[model samples]
Target chain A: MNAAPGVVAVALVTLATLLIGTWGLRFSRTTSDFFVASRTVRPTLNASAIGGEYLSAASFLGVAGLVLAFGADMLWYPVGWTAGYLALLVLVAAPLRRSGAYTLPDFAEARLGSRGVRAVCSLMVVAVGWLYLLPQFQGAGITLRSTTGAPTWVGPVIVGAVVLANVTSGGMRSITFVQAFQYWLKLTALLVPAVVLLSVWAGDGQPHPVGGDGWSMPLAAGGGQGLYLTYSLIVATFLGTMGLPHVVVRFYTNPDGRAARRTTLVVLALLGLFYLLPPVYGALGRVYAPELAASGRSDALVLELPRIMVDGLAGEVLTGLVTAGAFAAFLSTSSGLSIAVAGVLGQDLIGRVPAGRRLGGVAAFRLGAVLAVIVPCTVALAAPNLGVARAVGLAFAMAASTFCPLLVLGIWWRRLTGPGAVAGMLAGGVCCSVAIGWTLLTPDPSGWADTLMAQPAAWTVPLALVAMIGVSLLTPARVPGGAGRFLARLHAPETLDLDRG
Target chain B: MNTPDPGNPRERVRVTGPPRRRTPSAVRPPIDTETRLGGMYLRSLLREQLRLAAGVLLALAVLVGSLPLVFHLAPGLSSAQVLGLPLPWLLLGVLVYPLLLGLGWVFVRRAERNERDFADLVRGADR
Candidate 1:
């Protein structure tokens, strides 16, 4: 593939993102605007922004790659990711927005009335944010290397710089416009090429995917272990969406609890529509580009497919379009995450410090943005290539184990005490982190151990829930006196004239 | 016991007026103060919402969650064809997206209804 088009596509996406961010910055004058867009974003716009930010490199490129490489079971990744929002809608959406939290840590503080829990939550947010970010950075590296012949480091550096620029310039308000633009850009980039490619396939002859029974079946031949892995993945993704700091923060941008629920519903539809295209690319890749899987470069299957199937300017254009989408995926997701992490860091870590207190809210946030991007970019450049989808899966597992329990229990369980929240978070966070570290640092081929370590959500989530409930029961006296009032606020409709204090 | 303390000169004027009714203002809904009735209202809302959420998740579990086990138990399903593609391919890939969207829509509609009903009940009581 000629590098010129790919280079131009990347440049265009970067320029568009920066321009949109700057445009949004003009309206972002207050601290509230920087954090939650002054709680004025409508459902459709917020949903689009959420979709843009939520569909990271994992969804954009990794899903196609995994589908190309693995058989039918890999389809669960996309399904689980989309279904996550369903879980979010049914459970966490309205109450979380009503909590009036600027970030996950803020939610913890509001619910538990404990600075200790808030501090712990802030740490978890940064950890999950960075874990999720590593893959986006890594995916960017892979994308740039394939498209523009750049070194792996170049991609992360450029993406990190772009994210920092966008986040610092406009904060949440600016990134909302930038990310909403990205959703449509990404959709067009994938959809147009997919339609054209499908027609091309039909024109030639719609050949069936060449695979054995396992490729077509959900879990053919692989027995108990495969079932465990699949279930673990489902648990992680279904429960974890609510826990993702960037995703949850988007809800706070909605005008109220009702809009938040509406936004989530729209997100589900948007994600469902977007997810349909990746599998098409994946299935087509299986038929047209099997060598990609064999060569261990299936992650590039989406970018490489158009060029391989067609041989002309049109093919180059399709490649350019997909590349632009992939780049936009990285930019939008990274900007959202950086804003989320920076909000926490600015308020909890920096603002609490003597020198940091002297800096204004925006300045502290700008510094936090720089700190947030640099660490992940550096780590991504240093870390060996973990498959993009798998790394993201680990992050989901971490979130499911940690924040899922906190959010669910804290919102619904009035008896939940601060001690219980702290204990649950620590237990879940520690166990998941250990499991992730073991899985990443040491590759164990042992059967059950490997599976359990690789997909820890099944056990970790239960442990977290049990710890929270049990601890809360034991420490009944420690439950906050304002629990009833908080529950009233969380459960009541915004239309009701409640004090909510 | 009836005599007021001389050190505290403020009048204890509780003589003859009928006890004032504690009518909470509309601006400050009773739920905020967790009155017995208000607490009941909040709990009822929470219960209804939780049930709705549970119902959605159960449907998800039964419909989507059991597929892997079903396929694993009966491997022959893999060979079945639909639209010239294998059954698993169609079920997992193309069809599941719409199913998910439908599930989400159903949940949202029902949940919002529950909230609206709760709001109406509360407002009716306030009136």
Candidate 2:
């Protein structure tokens, strides 16, 4: 197996990412630019950047793998993933932008006027970011081992290093361009190969995917457990998109409420277009490479299918293209997650410490970025077997449980006090985290516990919402006096000349 | 009644000094009052925005929440062929994305329109 093509593709992507990052760095002069691109990013560009960052290894490789293995049920992942933006568009996008907060914690503190709520939000952001980043690193490892025959650890180290370099040096300004460019690169990588492979499949006679009745049937297994899992997945992905630390952070780049809404709209189209290609790969994989599914390496279906379907040089070239896309997937997502985590850690932990006070804002952010990338890289190396899509789902479940309620209530409900926010977040965080831990530790479980633990969003989300509303209702007087003004600012258009200041 | 005392001078001559009009400055809006009015204005704006958000969410809930029931109730639909692909694959894999994009487009347009209306209201109130 010649590794030259894989190596060259990976190197080219890394170099391009660095070059773009450096180019964007010229525009990042102020702290504000480092954080939110000075809140001046237009809708189209921001949407492209969001799409770039949002479609991680999970979307690129994991979805196709899951689809190939589980069939129609796995389609929920992409559907819910795209529809999550609809939820965001409807619920949080504009007001969250209008709130004028740089980060999730900033929104929390601004809305509730409580340091405790801010701290909880900061913790959740970091938790979600790390959980999401873990999969990217793991997927990278898998991609490298399969593509270049490199050791699994080399991929993570390389990804972590490149992401850290980009994030720490240039921050959001640089990331925006790199990610926007990555969206196109990834789209092309997947699209061109898909077109070629589909033509090949047509030319070779349209053979059907080798599977039984269960493959095409939705909710055909586990009786009620299957139904429960489906809805839980729906709950997670639909609500979870708004809560993702990286995704929500991008909304802050929009110039105003309207721009934020427009950006989300464009992101929906961009994501919708991108998602169409992955399932094509999945369906094609089912036809051409059923053995990969049986061998439990279905995650490599996208990378392997072009080669299996095509012949000789064309196949290798297609493989190289897909390898580049996968590499870009890991780099772009890891960088976005790293930036989100680093921002939180820099502001909440490092920058606030007396020792770190000597370090300037950039230095603190750089230090935070290093810590952010390292923890997940270590975890990916330690626990390498978690399915990429499944891990990403857990991250979504956790977000839906915690930040979803926080954002919704904080924006809409005036009675949301600091204590309520804290209580709700803790309840959701603890429940979801425990379920994730149980799933990780137990390996294979039987009956209801397995279903419930595997997909906890359905219950945990409502619990968090109930807890927040309940606690807030019980302690009405604790509601921040500034809540009214903040809500007003969030809802009012930018053109309004109210004394928000 | 006891004695209209001459020393009292008939209640200090009942001085009539041009009815002592209040200064216009004293009647001007106070800082607290203006803020109170601004708060009211903000509350109305927020109410309108919340209504818009709630309406959109309700529509989405109905659209997406029924998917499971539809598939479960009509199991045959999933296996049915559509354009040489399984119905579930056609619907979830292909058609669902465009639907999502369409929903997003409608929501963004409406939400922005809501904001525009809100801005108009605020501007009108300011005047």
Candidate 3:
């Protein structure tokens, strides 16, 4: 395969990203722009940005791969991911935006008036960010390796550098533009290839995959374990999206609560449209590249399929297009995550310190960006691959288990106290981390125990919620005096003339 | 007697009724959310939004969530073919997206409407 097209495509994408980042830099003058783009982004642009940032390596490359490897049952991944926005839209979007916080920890602090809860939330944000970033780095590594025969380390290093540059220089303002552009790029890349591939398949008589009954049916072989895994996945993705640090931070960019809601509604549509293409790739991969699945290189199915299915210049060009898309996927998501993590780190840990306070907001945030990108990039290089989609799913599960309860209860329940929020977060975070450890350490999981541990969201979310509710009820006196005021601010229309403070 | 005392400030009594006090421009509670009435408004808005959210989620649960169980139980449905593909393939892969988009549209519309209604009520009460 000619590597010229793939290499050139990647170079162009990186250049475009940097140019756009610099362009957006003109608008980013203040700390507000650095953190939340001055909270003035319109619904359509914000929605596109959210879609871009949200669709990481998992949606671009991992979903099709999982579908190829696991067959019909894997469709739930995309479904749950899209529906997760629905969950966000109806439950959290408007209130969170109305909370008038730049970050999740900020919301927690404002809501509970407890630095302790804020500290816990900050830590959770960093944890989730790293967990999410790890897969993106790994996915980039594989994408570059598959496309240009580059060493795996080269990919993570390149991605980390670009993300760090984009994030540190322009912050959220530039990232919004870069991400919005990437969403369309990703959509076109997948859509065009899918159309061509489908036509090719039709010309060849639309031969069905040979996997037969097991591939077509859900839980045909795995039975009870499969059912449990599927349901747990649903619960995680549906709830987890609201809690993702990168995703939640985007809501703060909206002009108001209503725009936030509208942004999310548009996000649902964009994601649904983008998601419709991946299953097409998956189904096509099944028909053309079954050997890739058999060989355990399913993640590369998206990158390799175009070249394999078509011949000559067209094939190489298609390969280049997807490689660019995948690279954009890595860059956009990593940039968003880095900004999110860096924002929290800058505000809570770095900027609060005397030394960092001297460095000031933008400088501290730049340093935080460095700190955020380095750890994950290094770990991704040294650690073994954990299958991009699965690692992402784990991140979702963790988010679902921990922050999901905190956000939901904090927004809706007036009786929620600081101690209750802290306890609930710790309960969910610790248990979910245990499950994550078990799943990662055990090479071969078996039986009900492994199944439960493997996908812990189904149980851990409820555990966290219960702990919060019970503890809050027990410590009713601990509820903040301003709970009613805060709840009013969160739930009320921004147009209404009330003192949100 | 009224016309006779033109000199020496002739008992000029201004009938103003002690500075009529402007009706206080509709005295009402400060709509501060910390107040009980404000809290009640908040609670009502929350309850309405929560109910809307719950309805959407339940509909989603019934429509999409039950698919796995339905497939697991029926098996025949999974095997059934639609346009040269298995039923599960078409439904899970192609159809569910529109369903999700539709549900999202409905939820956004209703949630916004609820907010609009709440705003009207609050303004009405203020008046």
Candidate 4:
């Protein structure tokens, strides 16, 4: 095949991920181990894995793209994505770990004492999982179609295959190892090229930032739309980080509440350090690849920047490395989402089966893997025109609206009854879902509602919280009796017994 | 006093004190005593978690809520240019994330410290 260097790089990365997953399978044994590595993952390793999985196609490629388009304003995506973890750490992570549940649905059932709430959580998990998955598939499609003259469907198919293979092989135990490895790969890919490109730009007489006739000022160029977009982004990134299923599931891998909190701290540091680089790439892109700024395809900003600046064999090598890293982002994130969605769906829906059915469990999980990967792939392919970064932002918004509020109320308030939980979820879910649905369906959609629909987290989160509080307070008698005790389990220090299992 | 009889491993486990209490009748195993005490201990722990979670969430809510206000207040930012973007835009847009990271880090560190302290207490009591 006459593949672009990117195609070859992506292929090699996929192969590596497969090999690693196969290797990870050797350590797997029981169901608990599959879901959460038997809850014994230490802080350092867990943090590395979280970083790996967390740095999705958005982080790898979208950051530079946002920067290229919006200039300094785009810096918020990386910052918010990173900092969202703080919310997770303080409000949900340690307690979530303490809940001893394998998935979000599990947490919901335990906390709210309602099968109904778990069911609502189950549906949202799949929706958010699919929304998050859409970008990974889209990024893959972009990578493939850009690099090779193949059909766009090829991108989603290839990523879907790799994700299915890895997720089916080892689940969380396997994914953790693979993600840790990919984090380093992503770092190296971006770091090495960044250093070389800076030197190249420096040697070529160091062009001034803001390039030629383009507006370099943040909203000066973007105008009113800019402020709207920026704050919208902040809301999405900050809150959306809390609701992401893949990221949340990682907390379950910690040995106990304390370990989970430590893991979050490490995640914050790793993310902060990683985020420092993307802005440099964007700033550099401004000077090196001016056309990306002029045209609106800054999403392709990072890929094109190196080639625009570098030349000959060196450019090819650098492009190849970046391509691999981009592929790593797609694989790690898709795999993480696929596993999380699959786990939740498989357990809550499928596991309630005839007893002693080992084959049934594995098969159900595998089927869920396919479902998780395919839905996003289809959605991404269907909506071929979205900016990858913007699409990913939508996913964050929906998550923030739905999961962020659910978790916050569920964990902290003893009086959050099942009916109240359902009401809040329905209100938040309907509004956000309608907004997302409208945004997706309406081509040529524009203006404030469009912006709000496109980024509903800011409004929807508060709406949900209010609804949850209002409904809960009105019918306080239905609150679960063990809410107090269960809350304690989530907050208490871990004993070695909890760690051992 | 209460200690674990270990007669029933699944449900009944000793939580505090020695095994028996002096009574008029033959002494009953302190199983009920430990279970009740354990229940109370567990409730307190949950209360602490709720307290910590609310504290962190409220703080984040404030930080996130203030972005538009803070950006409006910043000097020399032209509503025009700050950080290569609008002051309000950057605050609402890009600033929220690093703020997220900062807030997330603070919450997680404090939470972990809380958990760590709780764990130490548990370990200490065991000893």
| lDDT top scorer | 3
lDDT agreement of model 3 with the native: 0.91
lDDT of 3 by residue, A118-161 (tens): 99999999999999999999999899989998888989998998
Q: Model 3, stretches more than 4 Å misplaced? A: A355-357, B1-30
Each model's iRMS: 1.7, 4.5, 2.6, 7.1
Please list the residue runs of candidate 2 whose C-alpha ends up more than 4 Å from where it truly belongs after superposition.
B1-44
TM-score of 1: 0.95
Tell me what TM-score chain A of model 1 achieves.
0.98
Q: Please give, for residues B18-77, the per-residue lDDT of candidate 2 as tens digits.
A: 543343333322221337766666666567666766776677667767777888887877
lDDT of 4 by residue, A207-282 (tens): 7776433334444444455566677777777778878899888888998777787788888877876776777788
Sort by DockQ, best first.
1, 3, 2, 4
Q: Which should have the higher DockQ, number 1 or number 2?
A: 1
Worst 10 residues of 4 chain A by lDDT: A492-501
Q: Name the top DockQ candidate.
A: 1
List the candidates' TM-scores in order: 0.95, 0.93, 0.95, 0.85
The worst-scoring run of ten residues by lDDT in candidate 4 chain B lies at: B24-33
Q: Where does model 1 exceed 4 Å of error?
A: A355-357, B1-27
lDDT (tens digit, per residue) of candidate 1 on A110-141: 88899999999999999999999999999999
TM-score of chain B of 4: 0.54
